[model samples]
Target: MEHSKIISAAMKINQLTDLNTYVIDNSGEFVFYHEDISIPAFMPGSGQEDVLNLYNQMMIQQMNQLYSYTNEWGLHYLGYSFSTNDSFAVIIGPFMYLTPDMYGLSREYNLRNNESEDLRSMCNQIQVLKTDKANSFASILQQFELLINKEAVPIRIVANKDNEKYRKRENNSIMNDDADIVTMRYKLEGNIMHAVEQGDKTTAIKLLNSNDMLFSFSERFPNQPLRRVKNLAIVLSTLLRNAVIRSDVPAIFVHRVSEKYAYEIEYSNQLSKLQQLYEGMVEEYTDLVIANTLTHYSKVTQKVIEYLISFYDKQIDKNELAELCFTHPSHLSRKFKQETNMTITGYQQMIRMNQAKHLLKNENISIEEIAWLVGYEDASYFTRVFKKETGYTPSQYRENN
Candidate 1:
């Protein structure tokens, strides 16, 4: 099989599914890749990628050989045999984690790194999760990869040209003026963000609809006009997520909606579907700003809400939240209840239970595991809370849905 066919198929499937897709050559080069910036960036602050790259090179060095591998960091790889006599393999994914088996990831590891600015930069890009929760989501990602590999389709890969042709094209591409394209991309991003910040839905929608220049896609497959639109949708969704955050929408609300639209954009294989989501996402954030009267609530209450949504998985203290919000615990508590018509603990429980519903629907973990994932230490207590909210135990919800 031509390697480009596999890469294009992986990219299409990635757009349809909520997973990052990558194809590594036998020499461990990232020849093709698609990763959403919406997914939190994470990497060990050392030579982790270099070490893993060496392992991949070693595994696929021999022709007709294959390997299924995982490491201390959250990478699950399946090396597929691609050549009969030549040593070529297609390695897919740097998945989250699988089976919650961290292999002592939390413990100190062996990789060495100089404490330099590069190391600090790597650490800043990293985001860590609890052992149990990371494992759950990682397993889900593994399953997605399995389905993609099984049903991987053929895509019309644009063929690379000979050296003479390639050099001529490269020279022409360099000479071509692309300043306009860059300006258009950035202008749309900035203009949409401004509308969202100002809560001006009219301006945002007008900008989205009027911009044939910004939203136009190139022809890929003859019948697939939306082919180029697919890639643009990823960038558009990312910009819209930032707009929603700047609009002062609750972080929890932003997280859920951003995730929803990301998947929606992925599976939108039709031009109309892509256009609908494109226009809707821009307007949606602007509408949130219009509706969210955050001034009605104190900044302390708003900060507390943001903090809880961000660190919902970890055990949190009331006093600590109050201190961070710069208010007396008692006064903040009263203000939170009066403004939101819900207590602080009550709101936190609501969000946790909502997330549990998501995990129950999407993951293959046990009820006990799900409880722990949503921050309930005692399974029995979690069941009680779940039953009270949804009239179904976690198992029943999983089974019924």
Candidate 2:
């Protein structure tokens, strides 16, 4: 039930945004998007650095590593980001066990047949009656709605009419008119189809991986398993073949190859059952990879985090952590940033502030003691940092609460 809750919650929260979100800090956690509500002309804060941090957090929390397993199947993590230039890159990790491979495409089947016939007939009529961009948008929306209602896959749709910035991002240049956006998608799709025809697997794969691919294909075919199956199966197959040929592919990828290919190549129930077994292996060990990352370093940063959490509000010296984690001043700073996305001092300060919020709400601890506990020997300095974090002083917070 706990596992189910986490999965459902993760899927539920994914509907809000297109930004790559993450569930950080611990295992099997929920990924969330804190919407960046700002004017179009304004630049996002801190550029791509925060984006990378968020991605890392999501990867770590979802156990979206190569060695993690689902309950019954093994899986691999393919992380990619599509760009304005219509190019992207992926980070393929080692494979891990996940869930058993079920024979039927349950989600796809539901998506295909779940729409009311009346509404379905209406969609068909709309697709035929209107030759303009609006009808095209409506058709895409209906298909997207069906996919969302049935399969629970999170997708974002921004009409070219309302989203000029997104259009610029997709096309890599400013657009003069809405028709241009439609033309751009058409052109991109043509490029994708051309690549597919020319046996350019790399370009074809890139197009198929885009948000637009999912949109266009889902609308065009409406839940046909063959349309969906070829992409996933082919990618897994390619990864497997590559691993075998290269000899450097991880054990998990080899296992997936053996399992998926057995089903594709042999087509026996026994092989299918074996595929399930392999999938489970992928999910489980992928989680193990993420778990190992937390304790992966036998070094000081982990010690610093653990010690600070244990101490709660207690003040400990930076020098004390150096001895405890066996890290020198500069190296410790570097290590914390490398692993945790924040400087050691910054993390400690965040910890102190979070702990202070909890303590002030529950306990009768004074601001001064809370300061001392969080390693700030001076009450004034503690107050300053606290205000910086929460926008309220200790007394102010306590009084307001």
Candidate 3:
């Protein structure tokens, strides 16, 4: 977390010439760096003086000189440089303290920002230095920054023996191209869906909040272009198709925000009508895909449904009813003609309107409460919508019948 530690690590790394180095600590913790890369550890467990004496003897035997040390916060950090910018460092703390988690983190700089490439190199250097303990490897990098460079890059040094998920994320995020952004979008979207399906709402929420999808979305669609309902619907449609074919859920949710927001703010009858436009595209296209009735309708229909359902409750969306009916949008459109039956938007409006009517008729709550309860942002709008749907304003209906 500290910036100084990373800078020190970078400075120390630039000072080291040979991959062969030794860390003999009396600090009561095992030292590890990269195995099969650097010299074996020669730990001389004794008092600091005795260890320093032995270090001196070993250095004299090798004809080396001039190590750097800093005393601050009641602890000491030392830097041993082989050249101007290629060396390593160490931080020593109190006699009784647990070492920090240092595995896979860049000690020479903070690994948080635009310096990922440099931090990655430092990680590689840690391996070359043969430091094995996650904490010790990280300690050297942290101390290296403070001792030599005077700053640290934001980096984490957690040890992952076999997992390469981060590696995939980083690799997939290369370049700010549409393909790259879409890849990240689909990957994260799929991840969130899987989490949700597994009844891991916590994990799903965490994945959503992790900024990975946010970054991808922002990068791909600047000025919040996806904020528009129509644009978002199209993206969702595209992504849903991709998800169903590729079985990617992250992509589905990533593009469903438009539909989500529409559903969220559908209380105004006028807006509810507008929502039909968005819902129409999603349902029609998805049904085509699910039914496989058309050449264009691939497996993408399920993904679109998944995307919409993720943001809207299943009860309100009538997912079970939609699935059981096997009703294609076109078939219903032809049959209902003027009735507006089976269109995606029509179904959505029907559900919203039904809920509104129930709240108005069954409860003594104010129209404003009903507006919000049914997802409208404006009470007056809900009034107009109620009038259009039922031939009377909410108050007028209550007054007459």
Candidate 4:
């Protein structure tokens, strides 16, 4: 069976690394158990429950994140995940104990069978091994990282040719997208950007669900399924970062979160996880924008800012915003200034300016269009307003930057 190779590799890892190795199926039942150590004396003083908990924890953690799971336990244990196409597997530790330290305690079952010479002899063979946890974890991380990156091989006994052909067709359809794919990509990207900037979490999530990003494949890596999907994630990450900046989130916050997900995408090797991470990135980045805009502002002020972010293409009036907030314009204005230390006009203008900065830097749209893009109708008047804030007219600002 295909599983023989998997079992052999797992056992060799156990022998060479001194870690307890095992493979478990999707439902977390052990499929292969190594024989390097006797069950009763496997973890020194610890029982099966404590040892098994480490594997359980590894599965639980790996199921949540896109990468391999690893953690320290009981002051001496380190657990790490490995790839196994037939099932899940984790190598549960190189115990860092340098001395006997309670790890040499005999299991009760071993003591009960001591009258039998064979059982007593096996019990007497138990030894407490010392290891460096940091070095061991690093080694495990490297080995398993390579393992998960390889194309998965199934554990089935034989190929079903018809089923294989159908699956290949399905996979190719996902990759060889045509012209309409471009339109859908643009539409979804715009929808996501608009919803996040406006704090419209509902629409953003809906759009994310409605779109299943198709990928492009070349002749060389045609069989490498995850490559294009990973590339899509990187592109989405960069676009979302730009959207975040245009929404006026702090630059440092944007960079850190963007970089974090970018690295996660780089290291990730699963389609389901990539899809999950893609949706999560859009939703969470939008949440950050909403949170950043809502800070310190009253409920009314928050509503007003949300409106500005959503409809900055149109002129805004204080009375219209106050009606939406269910408060008098004067009351809203007073609270907005008190909370944010800026007049309502000043805050809205700052948002417009941020949008203008982004468009100017990234787009070939004209200055008049840029002003109109940020809610200004009169181009000449927009220039005076831009000068008042930035000490440069829109044209001058565009030229310098």
Candidate 1 Cα deviation (angstroms), residue 146: 37
- The 0-to-1 C-alpha lDDT of every candidate, in the order given, reads 0.58, 0.41, 0.40, 0.59
Provide C-alpha RMSD values for all models, in order.
17.9, 25.1, 23.6, 23.3
Backbone collisions counted per model: 1, 48, 57, 0
Residue by residue across 157-211, what tens digits does model 4's lDDT show?
1111223422343345333335545654675676577667767776677666645
- Please report how far candidate 4 places residue 319 from its true position, in Å: 3.1
lDDT of each residue in 24-79, candidate 1, tens digit only: 55566665666542222233412335234534554535433334444434444434
Task: List model 2 lDDT by residue over 1-401, tens digit each.
Answer: 13333334334333422222233223323333333221111122223233343344334332212111111111122232222212211122112221111112222223222232222322222111112533333233223223224332343332112124333333443345446446556555444433332223443444444323223334434566444434444444443344243323355645654565545534433434433432332333333332344455545665676665545445457677787777686777777788888876677677678657755765465787667545666899989888989999999998887
Predicted candidate 3 versus true structure: per-residue lDDT over 1-401, tens digit per residue: 23344443443443442222234333423132212232112211223433243344333332122232211111122323222232322322211111111222222223332244333322233321112342453445444434533544444332212225333433443454456446556566655434333223443545544433333334444664434433444454454345344432344443454355445434333534444444343343344333432233223343333333332222333344344446655543344334332454544444456556655655566887677555566889878877888898888777775
Candidate 4: where are CA atoms >4 Å away?
Answer: 1-220, 238-273
Q: Specify the highest-TM-score model's number.
A: 4
**Candidates arranged by lDDT, highest first:** 4, 1, 2, 3
Error of model 1, residue 396, in angstroms: 1.1
What RMSD does model 2 have?
A: 25.1
Residue 212 in model 2: shift from native, Å? Answer: 59
